[model samples]
Target: MPTHTPPHTPTHTRPRTPPDAPPDAPPSAPTQAPWQAHAQPDHREFDATLDVPYRASPGARRTISIYLSYPDQGRRHRASWQLELRTRKGAVLRRWHGAVTLGARPFTLQRDWDGRAAGAAPLTASGTYRLRLQARTGNTVITQEWPIALGIPPRLAMPAFRPLATGATHHVATMTPIPTGTILPSYTVYYGNLHSQTNHSDGGGDLAHCTGAQDPQSAALGPPDAYAYAQAHGLDFLMTSEHNHMYDGSDGTNPNADPRQATALYRQGLQDAIDYNAAHAGFLAIYGQEWGVIANGGHLNVFNSPELLGWERNASGQLLADTETPRSDYASLYSLMRARGWLGQFNHPAPDQFKVGATPLAYTADGDEVMVLCEVMNSSAFSHSADESESHRSNYEAVCDQLLEAGYHLAFSSDQDNHCANWGASYSNRSAVLVPGDAPLDNTSLLAALRARRVFATMDKQAQILLTANGHLMGERFANCGPLALSVRYAGAPGRTAADLTIIEGVPGRNGAVSELAHTADITFTPAPGEHFYYARLTQDDGKLLWTAPVWISQQSPSLLCAATN
Candidate 1:
């Protein structure tokens, strides 16, 4: 993704203060100093704060809270200030001019702003806008700026649902049938980008309004724009997991004093996603949020929930209560998500600057089973180099190994984790869902497939993998009786060939060991005893990678190691 810098040329100005006006306070000095001298005062400084709503519906009255504060020097001084609201392209949208007098006491002023131009033109397009404030006294001028996003929620007409194609020609021998009683019996692969962001949260880019030219400050696309981008770029599904707290304005200071207003803005984001999903057909849009706290637990992506769960904090930065779960306990968070039938996945579990906590490796079976998936590949910028040294383990892969070692049946997924506007086509990390050919491409089928763990993740957009053990699919569990037959099949991306394919066998309480599986497009194997789970990892000539979900092997009588279908 390229970075853009917004142009900062002021196109509108207003002189709110008269030059001859006396200071607001009585002068303590016998004579007035030159405006230049007043401006040059080392102690004379001001700060401006803008409180803009995270989002707004079209034609709604959006109020911006502006706060300006300056230190008191026991002397009265006169100054003029101007505020300008401009589009991302530097087009002036609104301007306000005013004058103020500094008294012996520190001066603090709060003002409400309605997004409108001088001619009553409403700034309604969805995109980023610049809010600039300038304060001048005695010829010296200082300015500060903030970014504001405005747009109407997306509400497109719904398209009719189309059933998946079904025919003998559409069937792939390697593809397994959906578990009995599932939505569809036969399945095909569907690809999508699962994680990304927009202006609704901390992500940059315009959602409702696009200036065509990318503004450096707001270059990321919003939910609706991102969905459109994904569909246009050949993706079958899209999910935006913006930071959960960004919409609530919970900064430990009750900054957004009106919680109702903050909640409204939060719901607006959900509504926009629902609207986009409703308007499109054959393309699925999943609504989710990245639940996180930098100091406590790392980030977790929650999908398919009916309501937005918020963690409210008090002044001391302690959790007060979550929107869904009244208690502030960490474990209860997962409990609440499960109670709402949401699927949670650990996102980017590496120890990065933004994430600090015990790795997913520390998760125990007590109640952590709700977290079913791990993000093995995140963002396009991740390093693709492989390390043969056992001690040099990557955080993501290490966590996946630990989960299997701990006896947790987890699935694998890869996402763009995109903050920019690229959406589905950024860097190629994607989740491929195996849905029945006649299954409806909607949220129910998608979520059901995910819950069933019928999926694979790939770093190459065009890569696909199919695995079956004794007629059971990836994410299924069966007993390892006699010889456990496993089949692996793969398809490479354009201009790329599979360089290596390895089968990894994992036993409870032991590290997973990789076996020298065949490098060909298809292979079969009968694992030795004590192998409780199996998965495959394929590396392409182009350095891309694909990982299938592990199939758990148990000693239960229902398990059967049948002959290979081929």
Candidate 2:
């Protein structure tokens, strides 16, 4: 084991202000900000150390950093290195390749391995493994191997039923009796980013080849690193929904040389998520998969599943069979998901020719019961349009509204659909769940809140909705008469105020147009009959927007009936 000296703590140097400056003058900027540095390593002594533990946990990362002395003090050394994980039998499990160059002074090279073979290979079995580091310089080679072990720990189980604390009052006046299984109403909103990726899929970063660069061509953050990043950014929950088939070796290149390797990689990634959630208490990590079909079917992200379910396509790009179903049966897939108590959501639903062609409801006679939500707002630049055009921006809203009209009853959610490792930093979208303020911030509670439809999707991090219909919060279903009273209250991020608020209401196939409601933060309204679904849209002075989950109102208590059936 090499002795380790922690990375230097950055020192902030404030600029000096002029003596004649006024008291109210703005403060000077810091002289040396951390992000301002170039890609070159710091000027320090040569050091090599592993940041990982001796007994590595499965799905966790083992990081190694190398600081090399200035290239012979004069002659430059265009050096490179390779890091490999080998089994006790001397067979290579995974390998990472990278370039290393020394500056005028000592500089560092760092990379991480997530304990799996490259390009979606299965996680290595628990046993003794050797991490081999090879440094090459003009025919002179230096090699070092360190023995380590890997194992999986017991997972932390969630409580079956944790009752909501008493003494909380409901804002909505229930026309019917509250159901026995309904989650309590004392809920507070928690923010999270539901869509993201690690190196397990097509996204970049995390590999030795990409690390240490100012901007790597690929994603550098692994699952554990991504989780920490999200927590540091103030997110309550983070779900990295990697593409299910992205590692399936279907492209014919067969990077792993084995078809099963892809599935193994996907499973390892999910396992990593579980370990992270168990290790972190306050911050919740949810496991999910983004099922994509570039040829036609579009994309769907299924969450909270005990195992993985993926679609299989033929060589011609046509659907063949899924993990379980014999044929390309959407209903069968939904059945399995429902059986497992899983939740499926439409990922960046297309508006034009790229449309999924089949809405989530189209898969089953009871899609509303299975497909819990749809992405009304996705922040991916590739999937989302900057201009709020009908073809691009309005298409998502239109599709969601159309589904609601058709009786799909799907809640609206916003996600970054982030391929880059940006995670919660993408302030354009988030999934906000209304959980009991005192409820345990665990997977069970969070999923329960989502299943209850106590959620709102927002584009701005600071935006919030205190919406109620005859006292029921957004996403709640209620039985009301011809005229229903609706209340909407908006809160904007600091330095920003609500500019306009609009209410949209309609039944499926009817004229669903938007009407200006109010410019203030709060407003009340009475809607006419036949308006079965209603939702509010708020625009901020800064041009950021937010859309709340729809509130379904019916003359009959269909919501209660729907809940009963589910």
Backbone clash count, each prediction separately: 10, 8
Residue-wise lDDT of candidate 1 within 300-403, one digit each (tens)? 67786656566554334433223743212446666566666777777655322111133334544433456778776654311111121111111155456666
Candidate 1 segments whose C-alpha is farther than 4 A from its true place: 1-185, 206-221, 250-254, 314-330, 351-360, 364-368, 380-395, 509-531, 556-566
Q: Rate the local accuracy (lDDT) of all candidates.
A: 0.55, 0.53
Give per-residue CA lDDT, model 2, range 1-566, as digits (tens): 01112123121222221123212333464563322211121112222222223454446566554433332324345556677878644588788766555334444555555666767776746544556666564443334444455663222121132222211222322222222223335555677877766665544343223212112113456677778877777777888776665454332122233435655666677788789888877687776776644223445667876554544443333322225332224566666777777887775553221132353335354445667787776543212122221111211555566566656667778775544445666444677877766566677787777777777777666567655676677788876643355656566566655544666666743424433344333344445544467787665544456777878876543455544643
TM-scores of the candidates in the order shown: 0.58, 0.57
Q: What lDDT score goes with residue 151 in model 2?
A: 62
Error of 2 at 422 (Å): 1.5
Give all candidate RMSDs, comma-separated: 20.7, 23.3
Candidate closest to the true structure, highest TM-score: 1
Please identify model 2 stretches exceeding 4 Å from their true place: 1-184, 206-220, 249-260, 313-322, 325-329, 352-363, 381-395, 508-531, 556-566
